[model samples]
Target: MTHPELVIRKAVWKGEEVDLLVADGKILDVIPSSDTMYEGAEVVAAKGLLLMPSMTDVHTHLREPGFEYKEDIASGLKAAVHGGFSNIMCMANTDPVNDNAVVTDEMLRKAKAAYPEGGPRLFPIGALTKGLEGKELAPMHEMAEAGCAAFSNDGLPVKNSELFRRAMEYGSDTGKPIIDHCEDPYLAPAVGVNEGEVSSVLGLAGQPDVAEAAQVARDLLMAEYLDMHIHLAHISCRKSVDLIAWAKKRGVKVTAETCPHYLLLTEDALNGYSSDTKVNPPLRTADDVDALLAGIKDGTIDMFATDHAPHAAHEKEVEFMHAPCGISGLDSALSLTWSLVASGKITFDDFIRMWTTAPCETFDLPLNSFKKGDPADFFLFDPSEEWVLDATTMHSKGKNTPFRGQTLKGRVISHFLSGKKIV
Candidate 1:
């Protein structure tokens, strides 16, 4: 008999009662649940817990090669594995920016050295424009060769239409999607609050939802015009959803994603005047959240992403207006999304599809097939487990989440990569 390295007994995999055997850091087989056991193998009894494919995040900020103070590749990958993410793509908004091959190489090197014992894999997203300034194009082909999965100008939207069009044209040849932060800089309000009753109540300048929708419309047209792929990042409001739905019907080569914050929280969160609630494409109204949910159900949203933007405490501790925009959400995004499933708002299939297959297919990242020779990257999750969100609970160095102090359900019990438990 072939000797297996490890066996997880009776874990529910895709709703099937199965026994998983791993060998040589790859899945050897998944047999029906049985008492027959493999001798001389490390065994884990995972009855009643979920054995699901680890998640893939298309958007995250590792903040290395510059702002390591907020989060470096090591801390970010650590947080990712703890969050059950086996594959994560980091955005390019560093001090020097990941616009060229050198910065891309630096990000790749840092990721390579992180979690050598088994951790989440990181893919760098090179800058769409030089310095993320929107004025000059970055070296797309060079960065692509340096291991950039995609290119993005996250946190800095390119306002010049012609320049953005030229960047997209250049990006098409890289064989990597150009992910866009869809918010019109000129129309976006300086304040982080969303335009709504809560912002009026707080007396804060509110960013209109049109700021996102207008840019979405622009990018959709650009995708249709250029006949190229452009992925929209962190879409927040209803109008954008409607536009995407229309574009999809018309066969525009566009894909979009919404963060957990937009699906779960509304602008009402800013009533406390906490800087933690502040995020770009700030949380919108219940009506907007409803639209986003509907978009998810109908397949217009394309996929789910955390937009796990982390910020230093000092960077977010100032007055709400002065504080930088972001939420340290890698820790809470999964559980909050699971809450929707637990509440019957979305199905288990929808959850798994959006979290795993959808994003991986969208970005061309590898997805765990749980088949023989497939890398053993998966997790055991306790749906019954409930815990509170706090500084200690988060693995990321930045603890700027608005969900802090809230009790959350569905915790990851064990995270395994390459047939070994890492968290």
Candidate 2:
């Protein structure tokens, strides 16, 4: 559907207040906020709000095709847009598992059906192994051609090095990054909490930081050996950070991400035995958090991801030991990450680049260029708005967020996709 010529006036973008002109679902031009008037264009006053490209999450689990009760494509896409994200790349951990072209095409079709015109785009990441079994490779090239943005074996490590090598080689051919959830299963058989003083205090099964660091070390070595790019998912420990830094210094093709929970909260949050705090490669110690902050500051860590794994209320309202490992991270992602900037841990530039350009560059996904003829995928953010998070009210079906009761600093007020306002 074609949209009328529209001008968003007085929106703050790139530290300057400018007027954006949109036509035919693309940015027509950006003009200074003068008395200049368009004769017939529909104009929406932005009220001097922060205007920027909508965020992109490279790691999210929408739970579609099989787990609609947890979160379907419609609900997940809605959640992404509400979180000020226009492009989200979902992992291949669905019930049917998006390993083949048919599944990938179907997911894309469903996403388009949900948002026929302006949409929060859904990019599917194909599974590295068939059915995510870590066995033989899936028809990855077929899936990539179908519409997959990247390849991954999330929720499980591709433990077999030989198979992982073939998958990386395949990813190289396809020009997409291979996202890996680094973990040594044998070492961390139980992952209720971080293995340390907290686990000993809570008497829960714990996963040590080394379990993740060990896999990261192995993956880095493999990436260096093969001269292939590997994206490490959810680095929660200092050991992993050190290894990633070593790899980057040696010019290894590696990019890494960490979740908001890891940056702000720690294993101490698990002391209450809340299942929401239970994430795979579980939250690490304060020292690890500091190390992660350092990595983010120095550019060792490439971007931020929600790892937005959603689950049913009953699923998370169980014993900590039995509850699934994940956090429904999309809804409040921007606000929480902005807090890091608010505290001066990372510069505002780093925050913007990580959320917008970094993930797009890392995964080879589409991004808003904010230039003439480019799709106008943008959002209006209120940086000073403080709102208490209510997980049950979030757009995603699952209400399993660790930030459930906390007050966050920033939020999205409106979103425009391809020049049409969606939220």
Candidate 3:
């Protein structure tokens, strides 16, 4: 055989020491580093670095087509690469929104054209309703034809039960799942944080846990009746997880995700109404965080996503309720997650499975592994490294991160996409 174009020596492949060979955008083979040498290949040493499948975030908000002040396709893709993400599925919450085929196709073309440097593959989700109005369904078939991977109305939940059911039915034929931001607007109007002692102490409006569970219950029943797969985004409450787990036990085809902040932080972060700590489904108490971690370990919570929402400085620099409901997470998720895993709160393999394999399986993408002939997508991580996060040094356009100056573990030194390097 011809000499491989790239050779990564002394790396751990699925936890075993081996040399990985790549050519023409695919892994050609994995052999003992000391046993083989390609005379003409560009060899790189990977000793003591973890070689695992790259992350695939199923919930990301690029804020393109209008909100360039927050983020654009180019900047978002760059952040994805720096964060060690090889595949990203974006929500349909753009300016005009991704409700039509034209918007979907344009976003696809923009992402493909902007990232010649081998960033994460873009999988755009189309809107479920026109303008995400929660009244009329968009052209589901047409948008799917334009190559959307799924359908969603993130940043705004579909409040109309009848309209959502119709969208779910029409969306079933597209072979893609419908993702819902399950929150009942009526119950949580103008709410700034989780309805509890924290919101009461702060003298701010609160959103009850029932607000989220109500919508989750409605959506689950809808999915069961329609025989469709439904994905819940950024589930924070313990009740929501319990419901989903119970539903799964009864054999409902449903899956859910929680962001790193929700799994790590709690309402204590919002004690003084600092806008940075605020987020949708609002951070819960320490008990809630404990529940989320347990749910993750036990297979009730299927995956972990960044929910990497970004906003401009001015947008988030206002009073609590007037400020935006998200923070930039792409660059922080892995390191924070690794901290818990390293402390034996969760296994390292569990971390890999959630950030890599589970999301791909849920989205119907090919499962990522280190086997030969698979796409050469993986991250070279120094699991023991420690670093303090600095938002100004981040590659993401949005500088609104909550973990500023906090020490985190497990940094990605390099990322590979196909046969080329992205970081």
Clashes of each: 0, 0, 1
- Every model's Cα RMSD, please? 1.5, 2.1, 1.6
Model 1: ten consecutive residues of lowest lDDT: 183-192
- Candidate 1 RMSD to the real structure: 1.5
User: What TM value does model 2 have?
Assistant: 0.96
Q: lDDT order of candidates, best first?
A: 1, 2, 3
Tens-place lDDT per residue, model 3, 1-423, is: 546899888987666888888887787887876757677788889999988778889999999988988999888988888788888889888988899999988898889888855567898989998898887898989988898888987867887788888888899988888999888888874364888898888888888888888888898888888888899988888888889988888788999998889877888788777788878878887887888888888988889889888988898899988998887888888888888887888887788878888899888775557666788887788988888888765778887777978888888999888878878
> What TM-score fits each model?
0.97, 0.96, 0.96
Which regions of candidate 2 fall more than 4 Å away from where they truly are? Answer: 1-4
The whole-model lDDT of each prediction reads 0.88, 0.87, 0.84
Q: Give the winner by lDDT.
A: 1
lDDT of 1 by residue, 183-276 (tens): 7788754467888788888888888999889989999999999999889998899999999999999999988898899988888888779999
- Whose lDDT is higher: candidate 1's or candidate 3's? 1
